[model samples]
Target: MFWHRATDYILSSNYMAHRFCYLLQPGLIWTNVVMDSLIAASYLLIFLALFWMSSRLRQVAEINRYVWIFVAFGTFIVACGMTHVMEVITLWWPIYRFSTVVKTICAAASVPTAILFVRIAPALTRNMERFIFMLSTTQQEKDRALTSLIASEKLAVAGRISASIAHEISNPLESVGNVLHLLRTGAGLSPEMQRLVDSAQGEIIRAGDIARSTLSLYRESAAPVEVSLVPLLQSIIDLQAPALVRNNIQIQTRMRATVAIRAYPGELRQVLINLIQNAAAAIGEDGKIFVRVQPRRGGYSITVADNGPGVQPADRTRLFSLFFTTKGEQGTGLGLWLAHSLIEKLGGRIKFRSRTAGEAAIRGTLFNIWLPLGTPPYVPLAPFSSVQAGRRQMQKTASVASR
Candidate 1:
């Protein structure tokens, strides 16, 4: 009896479901099959796209709070795809119960997706705004850095060209100086003409000194040798005479003793020139510069003092820093730095004293240099006698020219 009733109930349920099904004509069945297949394929493509988006979002999930919303969207797309897949399956099999389950899952996924979109919309908008601001700031910084790079490249090129020109000028300057020396010694002239020739010679010598200094900028490191301090300082002063005369600056020298020290001559000359030039630039017209050399314990102390608008205390600290200049655009700011480095290499020290214009009691700058009379690497074959002979020869030439 029980088996017969179960069979009857099954038959009734099947008949009712069949009544709901449309007539399965050949064309209609094929059309439904094709449409369902296409829908499934489209849903698969949508699922793939959503999956890719979700993976990208996952990469930044740690930093982004909106990751969960995107994840929910992907879940909703997957559920939708499953419903289409169920539709394809139901077209062949009567899996109506499974199709209903897939529909329920899709509905569940869509609810959270909608709620999350509503909750996270403002946050996403704020993130977009911040991203735009950061991009703009980054672009501005890149532009500024590019500009600075271009400027630096231009300055470097200019420096190279200047160095090359200075080097080329050095050779010609030496040749001209030699020619002037010959004219001064070989020519016979009246007193006035002789005086003019001497003046020209002096000017030529000064030009030669400038050329040498410029060349030294490009030259390699030179070996230290014994050099007389008195003559070296005098030569620098003579080289600076034209500038001094133009500014009406008077130079006073007091030599307590003549001393020789082991040093790099070019570097020493460069330092002296830089100091004196700085003094000349500092002083006004009719200013006085006092240079004093005195024997110390086992070395010599040379002081270069100038009456000028002195350096402020704040500026003294950075005086030896490269490219840090008090004279804007006009100064290279390398003189004091180079001098300090060269002085240190020669086992010497440099110091300074100054009082600005605000200090009415005293207002000037003084640079003190101390160099030890270290053991000479090698004795010069000819000593002070060679210098004396050169002076005698010059006097004789002048007298002969006068006669």
Candidate 2:
């Protein structure tokens, strides 16, 4: 009967609460006003100091593993501090109502922070193990290792620090996606609005994939993913459909592959996007671009061709070389190089053929990427001392070349 009464009270559009509850003894809520106010002030000062220190660390990009934990602790201090202030304010006014919202926000931030700290504990342990092992090595090895780390310090810091906070970005993205889903399914919507919602959902999926891929890059796990190139390529095309249409670029796809391959989807996606975008750029307007995926003996060949002015003969040889770009001021040159490097890492290679207007009647460029079926994942190499060098090294080298 009690449970039935509670349910009925909630289901009948009755959401307002009677009054706020107090934990102190009866009539003793404001008996010690002076002491409570002073204690509240001290706690508020502590919260401010903690926040200042944490923010300073964040500004300098030195957000170590414990930096967030300290910030969570600061939130706890604020909640407790605000409660004290509310308790004193409650005696004379209803300012405690505002404090309740602050307390709720603090709880929300702290709970997730605690869960993330627990999740990253294993990583923290492994890092400590690596550091101790590094300490035990010879002075020469230590010097070399330190030199290498310093050489890539920018990368080391980003890979080490950003990976931790990356999930925070993902959480908000998921929340946004969920909100969009609710809006999509809500009543009284038009067809055009529905299309916009569908497009938004696709973008959310792309963002989530990129975030997960970046996190995996930091982990450096060499496990090959089972990926179907057909749908995957189609999705990439869909993601870029608007831009392609806006540029007056006619895009066509021929899917002949009906199987999945063991490959890194993120790398594959990046490669396809690069080739497609490059094609789009090559043909500024009113040009045709074709993407073909077909099965071969042991692998699949993906071809991205554009009926744009082809590669100049002089620049053909350096196409896959590092930092080589034709766009000059507009190009960082890493697109093709990154495509080449990722294809190589996926246990495959990239080949291309181009004919300029002087060489052929139909001047165009074609990039062919060959990826083997079920290529077994290989162990990561280049271990300096104990820790293995990861994609960060490649990333840093790219940065150096760009500079």
Candidate 3:
């Protein structure tokens, strides 16, 4: 009873008027002020650093996905900082009641921070392990993974924008075609003029085909379709002709698969287009690209071959790995990776062979994509044994040279 009364008396308003006396306690007073002030400042800086980190995380979609968790932890940090501020303020003012309240808030905030940390600890550990494993890989592997992650996001948005671009290109191209038509059908024309007009008309039609098919390149349909390889491959050829001509390269395309295949046209277009573009880049100058579509047992074989300086033997192993580019800064190294991924996803496979420069009389590269007999349009195929097991089987059973 005596101790309780004494505690109440010490905390009472009448006995709490010690601000001046406390200040007079020279060494202790300054020590408390300086140490508490520094601590408060440190907490404030920590809070600012966390805020800046959150802002940066917002710019990267993959990293920003878990932003709210960090934000909650930041709130706990700020709450702790507020308690330190209250410590500095209460030294002179002696507002123990308010100071106690700030401490209570800090404790409350820490609870959620602790819970969140526990909840995410396993995920954090797994990611850290993955990161360490990635670090152990060759720099090229790391670069490919990081660049592909960033590029994947950009490509998602670009798909929509490309559809609009294809529309706009078609509109102006049609207008120009009308003017050319008027010029062609006009009365008096020399033989040279007649030939030139006919060529221009053919070029305009090719451009129109390119624009229409380009819509398929980006505006992919959810369901597969009966896609004719002839028009599809021809459109791809027409699309790339301008670039090939600029490099003094000739592209020869043959279509022996007269029947249509059950497939997603956009995916096939993207894969074929990437192959052709890669072929163009491979054969830098004065070369030939032969694209052939032939019937295979269950599906069709689409092959893109070039007579350029073939890929180095050292690079052949990592050719389909994401971001493995022979073009250096000019390549995203994503083409073959996407091609391989899409082929697998479509129940198909890709194989390639290359003879480096001077390795043969005609050094070149050939990429062959073999597809399975696909399901009907809008039909879903059976899943492999398991996602992980399927992937493991693919890695173990498949080979770059496997038929």
Candidate 4:
């Protein structure tokens, strides 16, 4: 029985081979060889592309949402390429059955690859939208950083100009102060003349102080010393009084505590001066500015409030940013930034609240400063008395002039 079956199988194979032998004719054989070679070359290119894409997918698999889908598609392409290879093999050898099996496997892979592509279409669209949003946000941040850098450069240039101006003004100011002193001491013609001289002297002295302060701002402090807050605040107010009066801005003060804090007095004074000046600038005629100082746990709080055109909501967030100003060309936009830096360096915090007109019950800005209290390492008390005396002299002269 085994011999009969073997002979039957050989006879059947030989009959089929002879039936297809006409395909081996020279012209047909050459055409078949060329077509098969072209198909093989096309399949080779497809296989290479799938291999490269798969390697790339593997590299970014963690971030890629449809990695599995891409991998399945690559597998389908590889299988399809293999079926083409099998087709090429069957042209040279009678492996038609093997070629049919390869095509069946390729068809199976293709179905799931198509299904996965359909399933991941929505995800790919969503990921594309997210990528676009992130790219836009990154571009915005880069633009903002570039703007800040330009502003910083401008600020540096301004500082250099201020230093040069201060130096030039200081010498002539000193000479004028000396001549004013001599004129005041030389016998006065009348009380009115004396009062005028005194007022002019006072203004000149204030201008000199401003120049000195401007120069000092660019330099480091000599040392941290105990500074009396009440006197410092009073002197700043006195210095700004002329401007406040000219603007018809009423001043009110409530000094609940006269605490001392270890700090750079010059810098602290600069902060207060900037705050007060800002308040005065915000207000119109008949505006009121209220300043208060109170003791807090381990520190003191200073509040400066004004009934002025309050800060706009949009400008609030960038209030302390360098060169961000609402004052247009009149402001250099350095006051608040410098104040913030000084306060932080002195181990203090400064905060402000503002409400625009018609937006709140009270329409104005309020600034609060908190400084840690500390005792002085050495008694540097002479300057306080002199400042107080000068303030008193100014008050007396103003009273006389008013009369």
The prediction achieving the highest lDDT against the true structure is: 3
Candidate 2's residue-wise lDDT over 1-403, tens digit each? 9999755543442322212344544455545567778888898899889888887777654245467767777877777777777656655455444556667876886788678879878977887688778777767688766854653555446555555456557898899999999999998889999999999998898888667655544444355678899988887887778888998999988988888998766557767888998999999899999999999879999999999999999999999765578998998666787678678878888999999999999899999989899674564332221233444577789999999
Q: What is the lDDT of residue 20 in candidate 4?
A: 53
TM-score versus the correct structure, for each prediction: 0.48, 0.49, 0.53, 0.61
Model 3 poorest ten-residue lDDT run: 379-388
Which ranges of candidate 2 are over 4 A from the true structure? Answer: 1-169, 180-221, 380-403
Task: Put the candidates in TM-score order, highest first.
Answer: 4, 3, 2, 1
For model 2, the run of ten residues with the poorest summed lDDT: 380-389
The segments of candidate 4 whose C-alpha lies over 4 angstroms from its true place after superposition are 1-77, 80-149, 183-199, 312-324, 328-342, 374-403
- Tens digits of per-residue lDDT for model 1, 72-167: 777787788788676655655655665677799999999978987988789788888898999999998998678656644564455445455766
Worst 10 residues of 4 by lDDT: 10-19
List ranges where model 1 is wrong by over 4 Å.
1-167, 170-206, 213-221, 375-403
Better model by TM-score: candidate 2 vs candidate 4: 4
Task: State how far residue 56 of model 4 sits from its true place (Å).
Answer: 8.8
User: Which candidate has the highest TM-score of all?
Assistant: 4
Candidate 4 achieves a global lDDT of: 0.76
- Candidate 3 pairs with clashing backbones: none
Candidates in order have lDDT scores of: 0.74, 0.75, 0.78, 0.76
